[model samples]
Target: MSYLKFDKDLMINLEYSLYRNILRTNRKGAYQNTSISGCNTSKYQGLLVMPVPFLDDDNHLILSSIDETVIQHGAQFNLGIHKYNDDNYSPKGHKYIREYNIDSVPKTIYRVGGVILSKEIMFSSKENRLMIRYKLMDAHSPTTMRFKPCMAFRNISQLTRQNDQVDRSYREVENGISTSMYYGYPEFFMQFNKRVDFMYQPYWNQGVEYIQDMQNGDTFKEDLYVPGYFEMPIAKGEEVIFSAGDILVNTSALTDEFNAELKKRTPRSSFYNCLKNSAHQFYYIPKTDEMYLLAGYPWFKVRARDQFVSLPGCTLSVGRPDDFTKIMDSAIPHIQDFLNDKPRKNIIKQIDDPDVLLWVTWALQQYWKENKPVFKEKYVDFLFSIIDFILSNKHPNLTVDPENGLVSTYGRDVAVSWMNAVQNGKPVTPRSGYLVEFNALWHNALKFAEEVAAATNKEVLATTYEEKALKAQQSFIETFLNDAGYLYDYVDGTYADRNVRPNMIFAVSMDYSPLDRRQKKLVIDFVTKELLTPVGIRSLSPKGYNYRPRYAGTSEEKEYAYFNGCAFPWLIGAYIEAYLKVFSMSGLSLADRVMIELEDQMQNDCIGTLSEFYDSSPPFYAHGGYSFAMSVSETLRAKRLIRSFG
Candidate 1:
């Protein structure tokens, strides 16, 4: 009945279920990620991954996993699955799973002979906590439930091994206990809504293997500490809730708190709604006054370019304009510090990336198209300043060519652009010159700022901006456009790199393009032929020299595939926009087909959300980050554009 339901056949098949994972976030950096079979297949897969700001910038796996054991008449069935050495599974409990779905929260139903129990997991919306509600749906006899938590108090990226360094100590708190494995880390608290008996039998779960990490050429084995287990009795139709977090809570009010959090969640009932739900998870609000857009889950962080690129769709298109403003306003100080050549004192990384500041203006452009008055009132000055700063050659890596007004990268690193995958300290895709997309964005930013300045009665500034835009527009067409009608990827002075990449699509997609209608149509057609995949737009054409057909194999192979030919869903926004721009209503068929093909993605990869990138070819298996902000945001934007055809 649920949209994302997995039945007994699929649940029992480890090959099908173990690779597919589910993710839940608190929007304050804490999250729950694990395989559908309740197996911890990745080091990043945890029951309670919390952000310990005092310790470091990365999210820590405080509660690696919690195994649930259902006991009846002196017999116990552990409804938990863990991979060990030689690919062996311990307490292989996935076979007991009758169904697994995420209609509201992720719920896994298990039937063990005479007892049928359901486990529902949810992360608190505002706190660093993971709550799992266990209900004995139907029981022939009295059932006792035992919870054994696997603790690994280490950064999510790192694997832990058994060491005497762990304190291995605990203290009572509320209806449960709390303990910290390390000195600098916060103590983890585990409690239940009802009174339970705690059995302090410490054990080590040695060499637990992560299949995904093993495939990706990482340290796939780890030792998880099992401090003890909690035993409690359950009756028919009775529900008991378990909580694991960084702080103690009022056990009595946990039921109400769980319900409260549930009400705030958007049900993943349909494709758009599932995206809306996943999109909301990327929001990181450390405090009520401060906010940031996390780039992706299980890894990544508050990246500057990602924040701006993800802002409008994740916030504005989702009808959270208030949140849009909240995030944009929070970025003001960082923008100021970057432009002024001051110390970069912010959590948002890559502020020095040449294209990061330009993307900020593009985000403004997207918002401006929807709400003009608010754009003028709230963001005009910010746009004007940033554009002026770029034009002045004050950006650390960017400068305007005095002769043509086209902004060029001066001393920028090769990996600074979005094709940022590096191997052996060198870029796989060295785009270190006048990038076509950067100039397209530069020209768009110039024109948008000029329009705002003119409207605001800043006549002198408007004239200056317009003059520069006109020069850039003329030079862009002359320098980037080739005899084949498509644009070059980048121009290193006299040498124009004629690689058929997705970067040229921006020329047709942007609000203000230097290309004429015919030129735009040609570029769009070229992109449709070379870069367009069934899933999205590929980073490079399949015919390119280093083009990779898939996003699979070892870590090194994936790094080679990262920007070589991997299709990025984020570029779908621009491709769809360009298609609609050139073909108008006539483009609806392809647009609908693209969206339909993408709809199937929700069932694969990470379940309800889009992955960071897909294989450039058929049966496009998702790769890179599990839940990417740009992927969700831009796909939402494309959907909004398609709906506008009505």
Candidate 2:
């Protein structure tokens, strides 16, 4: 498959200023201007406005600039004129200019200037004009932008209808004139109602309010301005200045017209430039060849450790070998720590965190799979040390019941995996007994270690892990399997939770010993019957008591409910793998059919793309959309699974 196909004629020009503000403009009367400003309680962020022109005649046009500004801090900064465009533009003749003063005041000022960025635009063939989009970041903080707007039109015909006819709706309205606002000073208002939603992080300390009014009719008008700050501490020779002339445009007409205008404008490959730029932004460029390191989300920075966990299949398996090397090299220090019995915690602290360990181990295995020469010469010792640590440290507190092979995590306030939840400074899933998925991962880890040891001629270590793997396998079958042939959710002697969830799929799909044909069929049956959704796999079966349909509440309540019933698209990749494995084992056609169904479902339900998650209810609502790097990467992986079966 060709991964680098570029539409050369697409003239979607996007540029960013020194202040990191964006400007986009196209030939089809579509333009977007955005910036970042303010600090403290009055700080706010979002697109200033999107201009859509209505043509009265070929010579005369009616253009409207829908300007929007967000306040970040609560009543800290006051309104000012800032600057005006007339100072730079000298109109030829018969040109009209008007400036409707916007109110910028104490309510919008804050300590940190609101940061607003723009997404790459794909011109619409149907819209004749361009459609633009903008977002309000970090809205749930102590103070947020109030979204003051002003409509500026020059050389325009008068509007026949009143201001109410303009269709000015707020907070997710597509083409209407309605005004809705959020109440907190620093809260977010999501765009594209169907695709994304916001979840407040536990650390944020702010509120938000969204306001809009269509009171002015045709000429030009300004809404109330709330003041805020965009404060960044500068070093000794540091200074910041603002420029006001860049414009962003993405229109189908412009993209189509680019082919004719290409030679006249610049002598360069626009398509190649776009791809190169995208590749650079999506993954770190130059340093890592094919490895796509995620720059955390828009609000966060690129984390080295998180990238290592997702690098193997997410980057290497997708054909970026250069990126693979960079990721491995970057992770060597942390990899050595895992080998030396000092595994790193979530941050930089040297404490044994199992999820990080699992990620490091997985990366090592993938590196070995791709490049054997480096594996033997450089990684052999590192691999063994990781294996030794897992075998020795992981099982110390884990107690295996005499009758069953179930291993329970026993330690003070330790939740082992990434699902580790701390509520009010207390560990929530402090499960002292057998947890289902953790052991499944443990079993796979041991089996992988055994393979690596045997390959490296370390028979003594290989035999030890092999024995442990067999014992765990035997115990897993005995304790977890019920009369129905499907596995129990978790086991603690008298307590065996029988929830039908997606966690069990890992055991069936991983490199551990395979389940019996009947057991595999039963697992597929249970999962397909209860957990599948249109966009992805549900975290838990709806029939389970703890399942909740909606995922909205206070921070504490939402955090507690995150795992109970939320649907995750990444898990669907696992389901596809598990289904294929079961089909191969049982010689069943149902699993193959479901794989096809899932692929079609993903494309249609998720805005012609995939996302991090979706609502679990029917016609599953797409959430956390917008180029979720993992969602696209995993869907590509799942596509490979179907192809391999074929």
Candidate 3:
């Protein structure tokens, strides 16, 4: 039985199906994302989006979509759906959908009049290839399935327009055709099993509107170049396969190749196990044996902050400590190189965030604690290197206040935190200075470094770090605690941001917190009353002046609301950590109870995956990127924490 299923009632409901999405990815950094009913609702929605290293590092949508039409008795029934101008969906193929189910993969059943067909989609685990298999479950007679290939050879960040430069011609390959819409782009091939006839009917599909893109203030409408259709005869009980990839392959082996990848995965049972699978999908191995974690799906790149923050949960909690260690080893060199550079004029001046280095320190601490004596001495040396780099204050935005020994970030153009949402190239929430979580992380990372140094008999280095940490802790206590007892969200030399935010929770959640027991309680109480929600923890407390209750509307509006008040499920991980730290078992139980909603949520947006964020108000609509890597990773981490507490 499938773990996640949507019947005709939900599939045919345009509103529901349009909101629901499906994602399939290969570790090679290729992915397929779209609405559950096979409609392209977002610019990121595509059948084939992969990194074209020759052109650029960014993912490009090579094959925007491939629509199917079953020709029976000269009557054409399109099995694809699309949103054109004015929100009009042509062919409205969702109406024919009988059921949509997801177990190990996505399977959709379509019933058109007297004919019954089922489609299954999967990706190659070792290659950037996607395969779709269709079986004629029950048919009255012989029918022909025509697949209309839509090509939009453009970066996923941009939209395509009707232009004269499009290479409309396609070269015939084995059982398919290879085509490139423009020069300097990878040639995408669409192949099918059995004999097929390709009709060169090249034209422009204009006015294709993506509602999500429109809302995000991006180009909503685009024109795709259709290279024509491949018509293949089908018989009852026959299975037809289609493959989309960089190069054409033997069509006969696609099914076997796909099945082999499927069986290679460890079997999953519960929702958390399903999430582990989703976490695994975020791993990108660009080279022979070097793997890194992609931040999120559809748009995010491999970021150091995301890779570290999500590593413990994505790997360690899933009983793959070796993977976690390898990822850490891979990321250390990058961090070291960034820190070796001279100071930046501002935090925003450096694209590789300083917070990423802090998170790396924290991630190493966690992994080391769990698997003591398992890591090599070189890993410990790497930790010391990070410490020396931090102490040097080589990052322009980061400097230690000698009087207090506390780290401060001076920047105007960036928030310097995860709440980074820029609209007009400026932070929505300009968080400069000594952010509460920043200091908390700083203290924790230093404490960790001191321990590693001391344990390795480097007393001088250890003593230096511990003394600095002590002064920072005292300064944090004296400077951050407001009259309300909650830690100040951000404190500059002149001003302190009194906004009650989830950032303060990190202070208590960290392995070492400067806050006393009473202070920790106060911060937790304020957040629980104002920021905690069933969906996730709110970025800003509702009582705050900057609060945005819901995240929706135009691109500007969404950007403004990005951190002001959107609820981020990923934060629940830290909140749960703080809860356990302050309240012990009761805190963990409360977190487990709150997380109950996530099980049902998995059936929504991205099946078997968690969304990046949600609206802060009622209904709490899931927003931002779907199948976000950190969200899935952190959710799995929280689950493991809860289990351990029990």
Candidate 4:
């Protein structure tokens, strides 16, 4: 685990109750001109944006450009919340108005740019009301954009209520309902005199002319009114009017000024800088409850929990016991279903897949091994639960082929694992049969289960898992090993796929009894020659038919080409581990040199920040961010692996 200079007070404040919203507005032709609206109560923050829409020559709008903008804008809104909203507060009510201003304002003192903009306005609090005014100084044509606001709430009191009602049955009363007022476009403005039902729409597909309803006493509502309007050719030195009006009835106590004062007390410490320089490559956002891997570039994004490949180096080497606990707690609940007799599908599904399961088990085992002092009875129980889950749900029908214990995964119809992809609703890579890497992962998982069971004094469970692990190892070796001594990527009798992929590295890296010295050397040589790149390791060898340089094209082309030849920086951990294993066995001087080269390579490619993947071509570019955790974690692990050599 990595050590970070985290402020306890700041961390606590981040966990406080808050809601936020932002509104960004920009013109059609001039993309540079932009305005933002920021709104929040003491409990929440909200955001919305009006972006420059890219148009074609014929005056017809390009759907692709619109889609891209929406995705990018939406992603930015999500990132802002993930980055800033320390306190999670859910928004209540149906009518929401967010405004932005670019011109100078009386109360506006701080400005990120020349634009003194009011970021957001929310209609959640009964006593507190937020209002933002904006004046666009210059733009080609006025353009307006709407945003779907996401709200998070503090449920401390609700938890107490839930606990109290756990044993007793009581009637819950719902009160304090607020209704949203609807207005028709630039021509007509229609305000709803009475509450009406509002239809919830997807974030991306939100357009004008949508109806919504108000819910009584609920902190969250699906459909909320956040509308925008922009008139083009406003001419130079002109302004646009934007503001939100709040209507509060039957509430005597009003505290808008007090709430504003409360918001002002929020700490503005630059924690991002600390995170950037920290030994750990990634940081977890407590409010959005997601992890971010600094993938060098600003644009790359990824899911948090998929960093199993980077965990050892990211958390363990940095000595972040707290992070380790968070990782375990966060992931265990989602993965618990897989541990039971009836396998529970995770949010992403495919939790039963060996690779994911093995990765989780590996992380837990390493955590226990490194932080034994912090290993309490609860930790042991958690580990045992995972072990029991894996043991009980052994797919009897889903056996490895007698010829090769490889598992199969395939196309759209059958969901094999998290890496599952379908093109046009058809499975892109079918592996419904035995796949080599799956078995390799399974073998390692069983070994880890056995180790955990033994360590926790579950002797009978340990013995059973050990027997299963042994059988798996035997089956894997017999089926996957080729005449050349290197493991085959996959095999189905005569139809054998002898690809030099990185999946085989896990077999030697995680297994208790890895490949023999000669076999290890051979595997390393093959991988280095075929899959290794200056930035990292390629998913497939360049010599293969599927190989394509890592460059953006159409969506289908990009996806197909990416895995075929794209260099995944995360795989460096496995490669480094495998190299160390080989060096330990052979007493090679090249091991130290390789370690130095690897570190230099990572730093050079990522510019001090590890990335998800690098281009498998000249002047390789890094892509994605969330996966950076793996790269950072692995680099840290590689340092430890080198230290072990010393």
Q: Highest TM-score, which number?
A: 1
Assess each prediction's global lDDT (C-alpha) against the native: 0.89, 0.43, 0.83, 0.43
Q: lDDT by residue for model 3 over 1-646, one digit each (tens)?
A: 6678899999998888888888889888899988898888888889888888888878999888889999998999998888887778997999999999887778899999889999988877777778898999998977989999887988988988999998887799988989888898877788887778999988998888887677666778999999888998899998998988987798878767767867876444568768888999888787766778888888877876777888898898888888987777666556665766644322112336757778888888888888768644558877877777778877667777889878888656875788888868888788888888889999998888888888778899999999999999999998899888888888887799988889999899888888888998998898889998878889888888878978777768888888988888888888888888889887866887878977778888877788889988888888877888788887888888888888
RMSD of each: 1.3, 17.7, 2.5, 15.9
lDDT of 4: 0.43
- Give the per-residue lDDT digits (tens) of candidate 4, residues 411-528: 2265354334456775555444456656767667677777767877889988987877777677777777899777877665456677667777776666464356787788888888
**TM-score for every candidate vs. truth?**
0.98, 0.55, 0.95, 0.54
Candidate 1 weakest lDDT stretch, 10 residues:
407-416
Task: After superposing candidate 1 on the true structure, give the runs of residues whose Cα lies further than 4 Å from its correct spot.
Answer: 411-413
lDDT of 2 by residue, 249-359 (tens): 222234343223323221112322221222223353322222235522222123443454446545555566656676566556655655554745332232245445555
How much is 405 displaced in model 2, in angstroms?
7.3
Count of backbone clashes, every candidate in sequence: 0, 96, 1, 66
**What C-alpha lDDT, on a 0 to 100 scale, does residue 542 get in candidate 2?**
92
Tens digits of lDDT, candidate 1, 270-374: 999999999899999977898999999879889999999999889877899888889988888888888887887668988889999889999888878778888
